[model samples]
Target: MTTLKTESPFIALSGVSKTYRTGNESLPIFTNLDMTIQGGDFVAVMGPSGSGKSTLLNLLAGIDHADTGDIQIAGQRLDHMGEAARAAWRAHHLGIVFQFYNLLPMLTAAENVELPLLLKPIPASVRRERVAKVLDLVGLGGRGKQNPTRMSGGQQQRVSIARAIVADPSLLLCDEPTGDLDRKSADDVLAMLGYLNRELGKTIVMVTHDPEAANAANRTLHLDKGVFVENEQVAA
Candidate 1:
């Protein structure tokens, strides 16, 4: 396994541009955008609807491509890698949580949390231990036997988070993770994210429109028409 250099920035985007075309029309979302996220940094991106916040997240996560420029994560150039290579790279290095829980309905909480580890060759006993540890980290240890339908939205989201972190990915990407929850549930999810960043030294990049959600991050960057307009650092 290749280990990421701790001194290097976890993610870097330089002169990146993304463009899309429709019938007789061309649209460029971001042109020559430059961004860098250091290791252990919890960064928030905020933008209006259709401002390309989600697109930016997708690009970072290897789910989408940019038309031009460079993208490097953990010292690997993602733009030069093929689809299968990128997918494999992401499996080993990136953890993502989306707006929807995206949990497997038929699986129990423990099973859902263990989904990522299934890709690895670790022993069954080791996998079970990792699952238990991560579920407990997310405060869902007791609910491991429950199915998604039996759990609250918050609990389900915690299970989703446990699934993401169980593999010990180098970076975490969250796209409106709290968008589907109530205020209290949203707070719980956000607090868990903060705890992961602080306690586990996980690097996180989150896209959200909620001001309070942005406030939870160590630093917030505003996106306008796909470009970074403002960056504010919060006091710890």
Candidate 2:
């Protein structure tokens, strides 16, 4: 088992809280959320329905605002960053994978994977080379020309991972990445995620409901109404 490190945290969340207001009622999702993820660590968060898994991911990614708290990732504070700054920060420092494999249907797999790099000021030739390299790294070298819809679930997810890592971001956030796949496809995606964590040394924070998927992480934390009820290290 990999033991918890005493080093400085790569991702830190202190006193984070979130709530949603319906038309008539205010509902609290999670409160006083404190977490610290070390560099090169893979952590999984599991929770039942309505337990704020997606919300937490959004908060960590700087896509959503927390009611109260601080989020410091890769040494940058996200809780107070403006929208444009947060977008820029995310582009340079974070990689995110979604459950739906959010590839543009109109674009080919290579095109979809190349989207992130396009934001940078790199030359066209360099962009092309990087797109080719990342596609091949995710085992989609020849399949880059294929439409993502034509690929299997596992292959599409692989393309997503390729897209996420092309920038070499320090933090990788995955939200229910296996939610749309079958058992075999999910297993393949999980294996690819594991490879990213172990081989590429990405500090990953994944939100999953599947116990098997959670087991792939170095540690698993269980979230309930407002806090973590369990934090257990998984056997490597």
Candidate 3:
């Protein structure tokens, strides 16, 4: 995880560009986009469909390659790293939350949380400890033995979050994390995110369509045609 306390930008992107080639046409998403995100800052991205908001998140998370420019996070240059190195970096430094929760149907909440640690060389005892700690963090300590399929949508999402943070990643990338929930459940998840940001010093970048979700963050940026059109701060 990140032990970065120095005040340099936690994430930086400069001259970034990405394009996709389809059957006959080439789609240009964005070009020469620059962004800086600091540690512990909760930032949200909002845009119309097909505006490349999720694509931008994919680029930042290193899940997709940018056609041009550079991306650096926590002083590490991501664009220049090899695939294996990037995977290792991502595994250790980032936690990603998805709208669907993505919890395995067959696994218990604790087992799902323990899955990420299986990639590491840690002892079983340590892995269990980490899983328990994160489960507690996500307010799912008692649901460790519960199957996600048997839990409510909100409970399942919390389990998903526990899995993400079980590795104690420094940065969290959420894509429509509250999109699949009802208003009450969405509020619960958003409040959990806010607590994580304010208490753990985790830097977060989220892509969301809900204005209420965006409002939960410290700042919101609107994207269009791959460019940020508005950047505003909201009091949390």
Candidate 4:
């Protein structure tokens, strides 16, 4: 297991708040939340339904904006960045893995992994090289030609992970990445995430409900009523 390093935080949130509004009702998700995650640390966030777990991930990914306070990611202010700038920053600085594998059915695994690189001005040769490398890293080197519909749930999720990291993003945000997998497959995914954190030194924030999944991370934090309630350190 990797040691926890908090000398400098890679992600920080200060006094942040988020709310959803209906016709006449305002639903508050997070109120004055504060958190910090160190670089290269694997953190598991466990929470019940509607505890703002997903909302927290969205805020970190810059998919959703906060109503108040500051969100700093890799020394940049996500809370203050403009929409276009934030989208651009997110593309290069962070990668997200979803609960369901979000691969396009019509595209091959390699093609799907190449989507993020398409946003950059990288050369086609370099893009293909990156796509091939990440696929191989995720244990799907030869399966790159296969389509999503032809792969199993685990393989699909691995492909999704390949896509997320193909750009070599510094931070990885996973939202129930193994939620739809069997035990063995979930373990495989969790192990891969651990490798990414330990070997590659990529900072990871994963939200999961399974205690087994939480155990995979070095640090586990429980959230309830929009606030963190528990912080447990897992043994190596």
Candidate 5:
């Protein structure tokens, strides 16, 4: 694992631009956008539907390439790395939690959490240990043997979070993590995220439409038309 100094800016995007081309019509998402995020900080991003919030998350995840500019995370230049290299970097340094709880129907919760480790050269015993530990951390220690299809929406989302953190990634990117859950379930999930951020010191950038969800983070940034219109520290 790569140990990084937490005092510095863990993520930086400078003069970044991204656009999509479809049949000669250009759709611009971000232009000359710059942002920085400190390590071990939890930030929530809010924006309208077309404000490029999720696009920014995708850019940070290295799932999409920016048309221009430097994208650095943990002192690694993502804009300069090739697709395969970026994939390798993402596997080690990042974990992603999706809104829809993307769990495989064929696997149990434990098996799903163990998927990320399968790409590594870890021993079976170590993989099993990590999966169990993460599942327990997410309060799903007893649900490891259950299929996701048999679980509640909140339970499945917790399983998704377990899978994301099982690899011990330094950064976590969540996209509308509680969008599909009930009010109580959403609170539970948000509380868990806060716990992870506070206890594990995970650097988090969460894209959320719910103001209540954004309040869970220590800082909140509102994006409008690819620009950050407001940045505020949430009241403790």
Candidate 6:
């Protein structure tokens, strides 16, 4: 397995906390949590409902900020970055896969994957080539012209994966990616994720409730009420 250099942290969180307030009620999800994820690491986060797994994922992705603590990714301090800067950073460095396959119905598979690259200044020819390469990598090369509605759930999710990785982001964040799929479809997606980690040396952090999904990762971390409670290393 490829490993990150010991001196650099791909993702780090220190003393992180999140709280919500409503009608004089205060809810504290987790407190004093610290984590460091290195490049090329495939880590899974698992917990029961309301355990703050989703919150942690959001914080790492820069969708939400912690009440107190620090977050740094790929040498950038996300906690201090402006919203626009964070968004730009995410666009260029992170690939996100949500639980639902959020494909644009009006766009074909290739077009959906090409959306990210559209933000860059690359020539049209180069962008198209990159799109085709990633689509082929995800095993959807010939299906590029098909509308997502015509595809199976598994195929649509593969297109979503293709879209996420089209920019060749170094970090891949998946939030319950297989939650809506059947066992076979889930397995297919997991296989693709594993392949991405092994073949592309991408750092992956997935939030999932399924033990089987967690098993696919190289390491598993348990989050409880916004705190990281356990870390387990899976055998290769």
Cα lDDT tens digits, model 2, 45-131, are: 998988888888999999999999889887789998999999999898788988999999999998999899988999988888888
Stronger candidate by TM-score (2 vs 4): 4
Q: Looking at model 5, report the run of 10 residues with the lowest lDDT sum.
A: 1-10
Give the per-residue lDDT of model 4 (tens digit) for 71-137. 9988889988889998899788788898898989989999999999999999999999888899999
Evaluate residue 114 in candidate 4 and report its C-alpha lDDT on the 0 to 100 scale.
97
* Best model number under TM-score: 5
Off by over 4 Å in 5: 1-5
Q: What lDDT does candidate 2 reach at residue 126?
A: 88
Determine the backbone clash count of candidate 1: 0
For residue 164, model 6's alpha carbon misses the true position, in angstroms, by 0.7
Candidate with the greatest lDDT versus the true structure: 5
The estimated TM-scores of all candidates read: 0.95, 0.94, 0.96, 0.95, 0.96, 0.95
lDDT for every model? Answer: 0.89, 0.87, 0.88, 0.90, 0.91, 0.88
Worst 10 residues of 2 by lDDT: 1-10
lDDT for each residue of candidate 1 in 1-236, tens digit (9 for 90 to 100): 12333687789999999988898899989999899988888999998987889989999999999999999998999999999999899888899998889999999999998988998999999999999898888898777889987888888889989988999997889999999999999999999999888888888999999999999999888899988876566647
Worst 10 residues of 6 by lDDT: 1-10
Off by over 4 Å in 2: 1-6
TM-score of decoy 5: 0.96
Model 4: lDDT to the true structure: 0.90
